[model samples]
Target: MPPPFPSRAEIEADQLEQLRALVTELFPANAFYTRKLEDCGVTFDVASLADFSRRFPFTTKAELVADQAAHPPFGSNLTYPLAAYTRFHQTSGTTGAPLRWLDTPESWAWLRELWTRVFTAAGVTAADRVCFAFSFGPFLGFWMAFESAQQLGCLCLPTGGMSSAARLRLLLDNGVTTLCCTPTYALRLGEVAREEGLDLGRSRVRRILVAGEPGGSLPAVRARIESLWPDARVRDHHGMTEVGPVTYECPAQPGVLHVMESGHYAEVIAPATGQPVSPGETGELVLTPLGRVASPVLRYRTGDLVRPAAVRAACVCGTHELALAGGILGRTDDMVIVRGVNVHPAAVEEILRAAGGVAEYQVTVTTRGPLAELALAIEPAADAGDATALARKIGGALETALGLRIPVHTVAAGSLPRFELKARRWHRAGK
Candidate 1:
C-alpha cells in the first residue's frame, strides 16, 4: 500500500530527517556531490537548513551539460553504479542539448508519487476514466502519468499512435472523464473538433491537467479552452524530467501554484548574483530533489522565472508552502526585448487572444543593425475585417500590456505554422 499524502507541515518535519540522511548518502557515493560538498567544507551532520544551503553550491544546466560532455550518457552524478539504475529518459532539448536522466526502481516510484499528488489535486478519483494523449516516448511525457493513474485506481487509456480524430472518438466512446496533455495539444484538439463539427463541451472529459508549457497559466489561453469546453476544468501544473512533479495548482486558488516543498526545497534567487531574492520578487527558480537520490540534483537552477508568495496561514488549501504567483511567468531565455522593453511571448499571446481577432500569430525577433526588432504575423479571425486596423489594435494591446512598442503585421490565413507539440511561436534570426 502507498503512503497517504501528508500535509505541508508533516512533510516539512519529515524532510529535515530525510535531508540529513540524503546528505550522508550522496556526499561520499556521488563524486560530483562529494566534490561540491568538499568545496563548501560542509558535512552531512549539519543541523541548520540555512547552514546547509549556504555550504552547497547551486547547480546549473550549463554545469550539467558540461558534466555530460565530460562523461557521455548518464554523467558523473550517479550515487549508484550504472547497473543499479533501471530506467532512462532525456530532456526535450527544446532549449539546448538533451540531458539523459536515469532512475532506479525506488526513484521511479518516487516520481509516481509526485504525479499522484497532481492527479489528486485535479480531483481524479478512482471512479474516473483518464486518457493520456502522449507519444509515450523516452521524454517521460505520459508514461508516469499513466502509471500514476493506475496507482490511483483509475482506468488508464493510452492513445500513443492514434490520430487526433481517432483519439477524439476514443475519448468520447470510452467516457474518459480526465485528460492529460500539453496546453498546445489541448487547443489543437479543440481546433480539430471544430473542423469535424464535434462539440467538445458535450464530451465526457470533465477536467484537463496541462503541463509542458506556460499556456495553462495564461488567463486568455485558459479561458479560450474553457470557452470551447464549458463543462471541463483546466488546471496548470509544473514539473521537469530532471525534477519530478514539484508544483501543482490548487483548484481553490487557480491563479497560484503551490510547490511541494516537502518533496523538494525551492529557492528564488537573483540570477546573476546567486543570492536569495526578497519574497514576492521575481527571480530564477532553483530546486533540490529530496527523494530522487538515484539521480539527485542539488539546488538545480531550472531557468524558470517566478515570484514567490509568502506563505499565508489562512488559506483554503491547508498547505503552508511556497506558492508561485501566476504560475511560471516565463523562462529566462524566452524573454524577448522589443524596443528596449522585455516581453514574454505568453504575454503577447494573451493580448492577441484578448483582442478576439487573431486566429493564429507568430512573433519573429531579429537584429537590424544594433537594434532588436520584433515582427508579428497575425492571422485574423474569420469574422474580422480591415487587417491593418486589427494589427494596430494588437500593437496597442502589446504597448499597454508590456509597455513595449512592437510592430504587428497582418498575414494571410494559414500563413503561420500549426504546432502539434510545443509551439515554436518565436524565431530569432542570425543566432
Candidate 2:
C-alpha cells in the first residue's frame, strides 16, 4: 500500500528539520556550497526557511559547470570522500554542458524513496507491471524510476535498445499495466502503434507516467495522448538529474502538479526581479532538495517557469503541498522575442497540437533577418489530406494564436526526427 499524504503543517516541520540537518552536514565540508554560503555571510544554522532563502545565494548551472571545469571530473560538491559516492550520472546537455552528479548509497536510496511518492500518486501498485520506454543512457532519465518501480515490487521492463515496435510488443506481451516515458516518446509510440496497426487503446497499460517535458500537462498534447490510448491516464511529472524528482500530477486534478514537498522545498520567483511571485502568477522555479546530502544544491535555479497556487482551504486531493497550476509552463531560456512579443516553444506546440493534422513538427529560428523569425516545418499525419491546404490552415492558426505570421511548410513523410527521450525540435536556422 502507498503511504498517506501528510498535512501542510507536517510538511513544513519536516522541511525545516531537513533543511537544518542539510546545512549542518554541508558546512566546512562540501567545498562548493561551503564557499558559496560563506561568501554570502551565511552561517551553519538557519533560524527559518525564510532566513535561509534570504541569506543563501541561488546556484546556477553555469556556476556548477565552471566548478566542474576548474576542479575536473566531480567538482567540489562532494560531502564525503570520492570513494563514498557510488552512483554516477550526467545531465542531458540540453541547456548547456552536461553536469556529472555523484550519489552515495544512502543518497541514492533517498532518490528512490522520493520516486515512490510519484508512483503512489499515480496509483501504481506492486501487482502492476511497468514498462520504461527509454534509451537507458547515462543521462539519468528513467534509470532511477526503473529501480524505484522494481523496489515497489512492480515487474519492471526496460526497452532501452529496442525499437519502438519491439517496445510496443514487449508491453503487450508482458501484460504491462503502467507505461513510463516522456510525453514526446509517448506520442511517438502511439504513432508507431498506428503505423503497425497495433491497437494500443485496448492494451493492458492503464497509467502513462510522463516526465522530462511539459507536453503531458498541456491540454492539447494530453488530449492527443489520451485519444491515442483511451484507457490509460497520462500523468505528468517533472524532475532533473541534479535536483532529483520534484513534482507529480495529482490524479484528482487533471492539469495540476503537486510539488513533492517531502523530498524538496520549492519556491517560485519572478524571473526579472528574483523575488517570490504572488500566488497564481507565473515565475521561475527554485528547488532545494532536503535529502541527497552527498551532493546538495541550496536554492538551485531550475530555469523552468511555473504558476504556483496558494494552499487550498479544502483540497481535492486532500494534500496541502504546493501546487503548480499548469505544471511547467516553459523554460526561462526557451523564451524568444519576435515582433515585440515573447513566445515560448511550448505555446507553439500547444497551438500545433490543437490545430490537428500535424504528425510531427520542427521549429527553426531564422536570425539573419532584422528581427528573429520562426519557420515551422510540419510532417502531416497519414490521414491528413492536401498538404498545401493543411499548411495554410496551420499558418493561420499560428498567426491567430501568436499574432505573428510564422511560415509553415510541409515536410516529406517521416522526414522530421523522432525523439525517444527529451525532444530538441527547436533549432537555429544556420546552426
Candidate 3:
C-alpha cells in the first residue's frame, strides 16, 4: 500500500532530494540543461529549495521554441533515446505557436499517477462511470484522464468523434457518473441538452471535473453549471501539457485547489519582476515536476496567474499542500487594458456567466481608434427572448463590474464559434 500524505516540511525535503537527483541525472546526458546550467555557472549540488530557486535559471516557452527550432523536431531536452518515448502531444497554441512535447513510458506513467491522485481528491471511485467528452487528438489532458480512469477500474467512456448530441445520448443512456470536460464545454453541453429537451438534472452524473480553462473556478460559471445540471457538482482542475497535472480542487472547499505536491514543486512570483509574491498576493505560477526526468523543465515559467491561499492551516482538507484560493485567475497575457481599465477574460466571463440567457459570446479588441476598446457580440439562446434586453442586461453587468462601458451586441444564433477544448473567444482585430 502507498504511504500516508506527507506534511509540508516532508514534501519540501522530498522536493529538494528529487531536485538534486534530477540535476545529477540530467547533466552530461541532457545537452539542453548542460549548456544552460554551465552558462549560469551552477552545479548539481544545490543546498536548499531557496538556493535552487535563486541559482537555477528559468525555462520559458519562447526558449523551448527557439531550442526546438535550433535543434530541429524533438530538441535537446531529452535525456533518453528517442526510441524510448511512448507519448507525443502539443500545446493548444491559444497564445502563440503550439509547443510539441514528448514522454517516455516512465514519464507517462508518472503523469498517470498524478492524475490518479487528482481522481482520488475529487472522490472518484472504480464504481464511477467516467466519460471523457473531447477530441482525442494530440492534446494530453483527456488522454491522461481517460487512461487514468481506466487504470482505476472505472468504466471509461471516450466520446472523441461523436457529436454533442450523440455524446449526450451516450451519457444519459449509460448513466455516466462522472463527466470530464472543460467548463465552457460543460456549459455548451447543458445548452445542447436543454435544446434537445433532455433533462440532465435527472441523469446519474453527479460529478463534473473541468479543466483546460479557468471557468471552473469562477463562482458564476460553477453556479451556472450546477444550475443547469442540478444534481452535478463542478470541480475545477488546472494543469498543462508541459507540466503535467499541477492542482486539483479540494473536495471540502468549493473554489480552492490543492497543489499536487507529491509530483510538483510550485511557486508564485510576480510576472514582471520575477520576485516571489506574498502569501495572499496574486502572481504567475511556476512549476517544477519532480518526475518527468526524460523531458524535464526546471523552474519552468507556466504563465498562469494564481493567488495562493492566505492561510494553509485554515484548510479543512487535512493535507498541507499549498492551496490556490480561486484556482487560476487567468493567464498573465490574457489581461487587456481597455480605456485605462485593466480587464481580464476571466472577469468578463464571470459577469457574462452570472447574467444568464446568453448562448455564446465573443470579444473583439479594437485598436483602430486612439486607444484599445472592447466590443462584445453575443448569441442569444432560443429561450432567451428579446435579444435587445439580454444585451442591455449583460452590458450593464459589464459596466458595473469593470468600470468601463463595453458595447454589447446581439448576433445571429449559432453564429459564434463553439469550443470543445479551450475557448478562444477573445480576438484582436486591427493593426
Q: Which digits, one per residue and each the tens of the lDDT, describe model 2 over residues 1-431? A: 65466767788889999999998999788999888878877778989888878877899999999999999999999999999998999998988889999999999999999988899899999999999998888977578899999999998998889999999999988898999998988989999999999988669989899998889899999988988886898999889998999988887898899888898988899988889999888999999999989999988999999998865443588888898998999999998898888989899999999999899999998776556888999999988999999999999999999899989999999999999888999998753
TM-score of 1: 0.94
lDDT of 1 by residue, 205-228 (tens): 899899888888888888877776
Model 3 residue 346 distance off true place after TM-score fit, in angstroms: 0.3
Candidate 3: the clashing residue pairs are: none
Q: Of the pair 1 and 3, which is ahead by lDDT?
A: 3
Candidate 2 regions exceeding 4 Å error are 1-5, 311-314, 368-370
lDDT (Cα atoms) of all candidates against the true structure = 0.83, 0.90, 0.90
Once model 1 is optimally superposed onto the true structure by TM-score, how far is the C-alpha of residue 354 displaced, in angstroms? 1.9
lDDT of 1: 0.83
TM-score of every model?
0.94, 0.97, 0.97
Error of 2 at 332 (Å): 0.3
* Model 3 worst lDDT run, 10 consecutive residues: 1-10
Model 2 TM-score, 2 decimals: 0.97
State the lDDT of candidate 3 residue by residue for 1-431, as single tens digits.
65466777888999988888888899888899999989988987779999988989889989998898898898899988899998999888887778889999999999999998888888899999999999999999978999999999999999999999999999999989999999999999999998889978678999999999899999999998898887899988889988999999998899899888888888899999999999999999999998999999998999899999887663687788999989999888889888888898999999998898888999999886667889999999888899999999999999899889989999999899999989989998886
